[model samples]
Target: MAKKEVLRLENVSFSYAGKKEKAVDGTSLVFREGEFAGIIGAVGSGKSTLLYCCNGLVPKEIRGKFAGTVRLFGKDVAKIGFPEISREASMVFQDPNDQIFNLTVEEEVAFGLLNRGMAREEALAAARKAVARVGLSEKLHDDPSELSAGQKQKVAIACALAADSKIILLDEPVSSLDWRSSQEVYAILSGLAHEGKTVIATEQDTCLLSRHATRIIVIDGGKVVKDGGVEVLSSSLIEKLGLRPPGPMSCGARK
Candidate 1:
C-alpha cells in the first residue's frame, strides 16, 4: 500500500512585501503520515518560511507575493483558510513564549480543543493526556510563565497534541533548549511520529537532526537543494550550502 500524503507543496513560492526575492522559491515537496522529517539549513536559508507555508501562515499571517499551491490532505489550503487549515495542522514556534498564553499548562493545551468546540470536560481530558505525552503532567496546574524554557516548549507541543492535529510543524523546536532538554523534546516528537503523526521540524543542528529525523530536507537560498533519506547528510551540497557537516559521531556519519 502507498503512504498517505498529508501535506503537499507544488512549485510554491512566496516573496515578502518589498523583498526582492522569494522567501520560499518554487519549492515542491510531499510529506506523508508517520514521517519524522527534518528541515536543516543556515540562518537565512528559508527553512522557517517553508515550514510556515505548510500550515498556511505564509499567505495568511505574513503577506507576500504567493504563487503555486499548498495542500493538506489533498485539499487546497488557500480555499480552506487558516482557521480551517489549523484544524488538521498545528504549528509550534521556536520560542515557547510566543505560543503559551494561558494561565496553566493544562489550560494552554486545552485552549485549542476548546476553540474547536470540544466539550469542556472532554477538552480537559484531552489536555491532560497531551500533557502526559510531553512528560509535563507534573506541571499540569503550574503557571506557564514559571516553567523552564524546555518545559515551556513541551507545553507548546502538548497544545498540538491536544488538538489531535494530523500534522505538526515545529520551527527550531529545541533551539533554545539545553542539551538534555533537546534530547527529551526530540524523544517526544519521535514518539508522536511513531504514533502516526506527521512531524516536520526545522533545526540548525545537523547532528541532532541526523540522529532523530527519519528523513532530511535541505533548504538553501529559499529552495530545496536536497530531499531524501539520512544519506543526504553525506552530500557535499550540504556543506557547500553553508550547513555544517554531520558530526563525527552522528548517525549520518559517512561510511
Candidate 2:
C-alpha cells in the first residue's frame, strides 16, 4: 500500500510584512504518516517559516503574504483554520521555556487538554501517561524552570503527546543542548515516531539528523534542494550545499 500523506505544501510561498524577499519561495513538499523527517538548512533559509506553514501558523497567525496551498490531512489549512489544524498538529518552539509556563510539569502538559474541555481529573491522568512516555514521571511535580534545557524540551514533547497530536513539528529542537542531552531528546522523538506519530523537526546537527531522521530534507533559500533517505547524508551533495558532513562520515566512516 502507498504511504498516507499527512501534510502537503504545493507551490507554497510566504513573504513577511515589509519584506521584499519571500521567506518561503515556491516550496512544495509532502510529509507522510509514520515518518521522521528532518529539515536542514543554513541560517535564514526559510526552514522555520515552512514549519510554521505546516500547522497554519503562517498567514493565519503570523500575518504574512501567503500563496499556493498548504493542506494538512487532505483539508486545506487556510480553510480549516488554526484551532482545527492545531487539534491534529502541534508545534514545539526551539525554546521550551516559551511553551512550559505552568507552575508544574503536570500542569504544563494538562493545560492544553483543560483548555480543550477535558475534565481536570481526566486531563491529569492523560498528562501522567504523556510524562511517562518522555521518562519524566518522577518529575511530574517539579518546577519546569528548574529542569535542565533538555528535560524542558522533553516536557514540551510530553505536552504535545498529551494533547493527542498526530503531527509534531519542532524547530531546532536541540540547538542549545550538549551532545548527550541532544541524543536523549532525539531518542525520545524517535520513540514517538516508532509509535506512529509523525515527527517533523529542523536541526543543524548533521550527525544527529543522519542517524536519527528516517528522511532528510535539505532546504535552501526557501526551496527544497534535496529530499531522500539517510543515505543522502553520506553523499557529496553535503559539501556542495556548504553543509558539514554527517558525523559518521566526518569520523572516517564509509560513504
Candidate 3:
C-alpha cells in the first residue's frame, strides 16, 4: 500500500529574532503517513527550528521572519493558529520536566483531552489506555514529578496519544535518557509508526534511530544534508557528517 502525504514544506526559511543567520534555510521536503523519520545534524543545525515550522511555532509565537510555506494535512500552517495545527501535529520537547506538571501520571496524560472538553471520567479512561500503550499503566496514580526521566518522557508521549495527535513531533526525546531507556522510547515510536502515524523526531542517538526509524534525514547549516534509509548512517558518511557512527546497520530498521 502507498502511504499518503502528511506534510510538505516548500522553500522554507526562518531567521530568529535578532539573529543574523537563518535558523532554517531554504529547505523543502515531503513527509508521509506511517513514517518514523529521524532527523540528525550538528549542534545549531536548525533541526528543532524545522520542527517548530511544521507546527507553526516559527514566525508565530517565536516571532521571527519566516519565508516560504509549511503545509500540514494540506493546510497552510501560517494560515492557522497553534491550537488548530497542534491537534494534528503534537510536539514533544527535549526536556520532559518542561512538559510535565500534573500531580499524577493520569492527570498529566489527560490534561489535553480535558482541555478539549472531554468528560472527566472519559478523559481519565482515555489517559489510562494511552499510558498502558506506553507501558506505564502501573504508574497511573504515581506522581509524574518523581518518575524517572524516561518514564516522564513516556507520559508526555501519552499526552499526545490521548489528544489523538496524528503526527508526533519530538525534539531530542531521549537526550537525557540512558541507553536502555533510549532504546525503549525509540521502540515505542516504531510501534506508533507501524500503527500508521507520522513520527518525526530530532535525535542525537543515531544507533537508536538506525534500529527504528523508517527514514533518516540529516541536516546541517540549516538545510538537509542527507535523507534516506539506514544506509545513510554508514560509518564513513556519519564520520564525514560529524555524527556518531551507529555501528552496524541493525536489521531491525523498519521498512
lDDT by residue for model 3 (151-227), tens: 99999988888888889999999999987888788888888899999999998788888788878889888999888
lDDT of 1 by residue, 73-181 (tens): 9999888866678789999999999877889998889998888788999999999999998888899999999999999999998888888888999999999998889
Please state the error at residue 139 of candidate 3 in Å: 1.4
After superposing candidate 2 on the true structure, give the runs of residues whose Cα lies further than 4 Å from its correct spot.
249-255
lDDT of 3 at 69: 96
Off by over 4 Å in 3: 249-255
103-178 per-residue lDDT for model 2 (tens digits)? 9999999988888888999999999999998889999999998999988998988888898888999999998788
- Which pairs, if any, clash in model 3? none
TM-score of each: 0.95, 0.94, 0.94
lDDT of each: 0.89, 0.87, 0.88
Clashing pairs in 2: none
What local lDDT score does residue 114 receive in model 3, on the 0 to 100 scale?
A: 84
Number of the top-ranking candidate, with TM-score as the measure: 1
Count backbone clashes in candidate 1.
Answer: 0
Best by lDDT: 1
